[model samples]
Target: MSLIEARQADPKRLIAGATGEWEIIIGMEVHAQISSRSKLFSGAATDFGAEPNDNVSLIDAAMPGMLPAINAECVRQAVRTGLGLRAKINLTSVFDRKNYFYPDLPQGYQISQFRQPVVGEGKILVSVGPDNKGRFEEVEIGIERLHLEQDAGKSLHDQHPTMSFVDLNRAGVALMEIVSRPDLRSSEEAKAYLTKLRMIVRYLGTCDGNMDEGSMRADVNVSVRRVGEPFGTRCEIKNVNSIRFVGQAIDYEARRHIAILEDGGTIAQETRLFDAAKGETRSMRSKEEAHDYRYFPDPDLLPLKFDQEFVDKLAADLPELPDEKKKRFIEALGLSAYDASILVSEKAVADYFEALVAAQPDVEKDGKAAANWVINDLLGALNRSALPIEKSPIKPEQLSEIIRLIKTGVISGKIAKDVFEIIWQEGGDPQKIVAQRGLEQVTDNAAIEKAVENIMRANPDKVEQAKTKPGLAGWFVGQVMKATGDKVNPQTVNIVIKQKLNLED
Candidate 1:
């Protein structure tokens, strides 16, 4: 509603300067490459890992007579991304020339948007943190605008001992610059905002959101202010690729700003670079205002206008986003908010969970069970190995089979983990592994009774203590399970030990 009311500032996040406490205000300008086969205007290839200049065209190379043409697919993707963000879609938007001098930009002035953008103000609800109750606190990050622009080629300075190299392969590629309002207050909120933003774009299929390969990056604008004061002069941190680096840069820059301001120094508005290795932000150049760019309408491009039907068609084909999926997991699938949030954070993880549920004969009965194994076991194991869900050693059906085995009493939960390890190391059917390895749970009543009797008779001293301290029955359960090679259900052993020792409930 209001600016101060809209921002969710944590009192603890306030910085303690020499004089008083200060707050960090952050905004983000993220550049995401559109997942298209060709560049935004030229017909040049847009594939990554291409040879130097292999993907360039005459227009991309700034040949004398080459003209630029709009790529309709890039327009569609920007609109789709706009709808995904729940932002307003302006039917009529214009592209302007961003005049700048760079070694990588073949065109003297880059074509971009200034006043008119395809997507207008929107909001993203980001869930941050596990507070005291282990719950994510939801905060809304406002999107200012999203505009389409052409990417500049990459300049490789480390290719040789002294000489530099320029690769035009990335030139003329499509890019969507999404600008966020200065609503972020802390490093935690900044990381959560970036994470949520990346997830949304990945879900929309607009961008791959791969920060490593430079498919997505952010230029962080950071400023510091006293609690009730107006905004401070902001510095732009250019081209931070990783989320961890973003947090690091913000932390370093915020403290730098606070140290300067607290020492009776005014912050100079400038563009800076985050030195990830040094963990600091260094000045790149003085910040340029809109007037400095001397923005004018691009002579080559026409005003981008589309009908409402185009937007409606794209909206109808959208997939179920993370928020909707998380709600369904909680309401219909009986998953906890924490579990559902983790599962739906990534599309692949959610799909795997859904597949496990679908494979079960009883969805309601096995939903929580599936969640436990997935989150606690599967995801845990993957994280330990530094592997992704797509690269998991165990598939959904294989995990489903393990759950099914436990459900059908073929194996105990303890033994199921053993079976899981076997599958992880050596691929095999869970059912066959249980049967062939003699790992099935010993569910026979008579066999369990015999094992309990033998264990009790051999440990008379412990049995005497068990009569007074019934909790000693747990020792007997462990012995019996160990003698039975841990194949018996633990619940069954606990019951047999209780009955044998005459322990109270």
Candidate 2:
């Protein structure tokens, strides 16, 4: 077997079917639009939301006299993305004509790369499972190749009853098709792999990786077989817009295959479209073999050639990617693997965490506290508010201020959360809020002692029970804090409550 097909599926990831257990094998071809102002072979505007055909140039329209001139920025971006994938960069690669008929394709054939792509094999290490407990099962997904190509326009079939309208705003727009080896087995693995791949492209700044914008999408190839058997016939699910939908399509298709096999039915190799509303895959057409396209080298464009320095410069400018940053967070800052993974999942989230740590110097030693607040509190609040991290009401400085107060015993954790809600709703300096509102924890020994003594006096019956059943001291502690408006640190209240009740720690 080739290196890409060498591995066996994890027994745990096998799907439990009607009659027996089956294994699923998945491969993905992710088409990511190159982040550029112009199209790949023409100076046509690549802007979205423009009037139909307004962004297209004479070349994009394939006019008789027009010649193809590649945008250098698109090529540079493709190369930079290849380097970011940790894939080998080919010094030379050729563009070929993919012959096909489509309503939206202005050119009779799509100018694309084949045989020798710009990028070679690469691997992305994805961690699956709960993504917590500082625990994960790492799976290495192989990237077969990344080829540069042009995107077709959108066909607006709903605009007319029988006639169709073509919007060439996206025509000739640059794209990088990153194909993965058949290394994924389960829907969860496919989801994680897609997420990590998107994360990489986003980190590289080559593609925005926005599926909703039609800037990025995936074609999933799914096949199923019994354990210890060869690969079975695969069906391709086309243009799954969302990562969630990708998983849904795979789950539905794999089960369909398993059920068909169990019932003694043969599988057909076909291209299918995922009906997300119905949660199933429907046949689109017969799956095309490579020879069906009749691929031939494009006569208009020359081969893409770049030197080592070109690739070297782009690699040198790359920012710390997710894996490296995650490693640093775990080793240098002492963050748990799960926490580190979460913090570095997005570049903005990682930036927020680093800034928070920079703001609170004490958290540098142990970023678990900062990670918890970011992942649990700030992220949770952002998600609830339907806001992105960039639109956060609580800045890094503002949150670090709250952390400072809690660490310094200026406010109890409970009071801090109250302050957090107040700050979350309306902006304010956390320290100033605590000072102005007298919200600081009542850490005074005399104050706690007085509250404890009063609770003992009022509940004389419970005070006796406290001495015998020492757990009743907890009841006294709560009542003392309640009597004092819950402004005191529970830890200090517990200590003094124990002293008043004469109970051991």
Best by lDDT: 1
Query: For each candidate, what is the lDDT?
Result: 0.90, 0.88
Clashing residue pairs for model 1: none
TM-score of each: 0.96, 0.96
Q: Put down candidate 1 lDDT per residue, 22-116, tens digits, no spaces.
A: 88999999999999999999898898998899999999999998999999999999999999999999999999999998889998778899899
Q: Per-residue CA lDDT of candidate 2, range 385-420, in tens?
A: 999999999999999888888888898887888888
lDDT of 1 at 237: 95
Q: Which segments of candidate 2 are over 4 A away from where they belong?
A: 1-4, 131-134, 362-366
131: Cα error in model 1, Å: 3.0
